[model samples]
Target: MIARIAMLFVAAAPLALAACATPAGEYPSLAQREIERVGMVMTPPQTTPAPPPNPTEPVLSQARELVESVRTAHAAFLASESAVRSRVAAARGATAGSDAWALAEVALAGLSTQRSRAMVALADLDRLFIAASTSGESTETIGEARSEAADMVAAEDAVLSELSAQLAS
Candidate 1:
């Protein structure tokens, strides 16, 4: 009889513990339950409106001017492109320091000067980009202008290199 009673108690022990344990889905939430009782509505933060756009900003105008200068220089370069190429072609078989070679060298120098003019404008645009970036201003205009000037200068460099190679040969 004592063995039977021990068996019954052992079988009932888990049932008693299960009664004390709460269900997983029945736990209490940590969220506020009575915010309305405080009688105040929650409001989002207010933000300031943006300023109106200005078309005459000095930095933008300066960028425009610099880009225009690059274009002008590029135009000048194009104007002399044919003459320089002719001189280089003429000097193709000439000995070093001969008259033809000298003329070719002068033509190359003139072309390089034009390229330098565009590069100088590009350098100014670079400075403007740095200044705008450091001062928390937008650098889009300056960057665009710099790209244009750099492209023009690169094209000029290619032409100069080709002509110089011809003259050297």
Candidate 2:
């Protein structure tokens, strides 16, 4: 009876843990979304847009908006991978057959398509930026901005790689 109860507890624990995930992973709060919306557009735009519905908050800075629109959909994928890694580490001693491990695996798989989409977006973004130099901008100015963008891409790639490893394990 004790063995059976232990098995039942093992089986139910992943679900219990999952329930504890309130915000789950890196979902953007409305404010983070707005801040992220603004911080990204350090580059000056070629043209100004028309008036926004809320003068208080432009939907996003156009250049930053463009960058994020390309970059951030990876949140779901990265966040799931992060969650799984944490779960696996937490359940490190469990049997391979345990429900907790299986739950983590399932969550990882659910995020696969989102990962693929994010990769495609990143690739497309890279391609678009290849000739991103504007005539008015000095070469140093364009180079600096591209360097900054490259840094951002590299950081994101590192996160994605860690996530991929967790999923693989």
Highest-lDDT candidate: 1
- Candidate 1: misplaced stretches above 4 Å? 1-56
Tens digits of per-residue lDDT, candidate 1, 45-160, equal 99898996763388889999999999999999999999999998889899999999999999999989999999999999998899899988888878888898899999999999
Root-mean-square deviation (CA) per prediction: 11.0, 31.3
**Candidate 1: clashing pairs of residues:** none
Model 2, residue 29: distance off in Å is: 82
lDDT (0 to 1) per candidate: 0.90, 0.55
- What are the models' TM-scores? 0.66, 0.38
Model 2, C-alpha of 119: deviation from truth (Å): 1.7
The lDDT, on a scale of 0 to 1, for candidate 1 is 0.90
| Best candidate, TM-score | 1
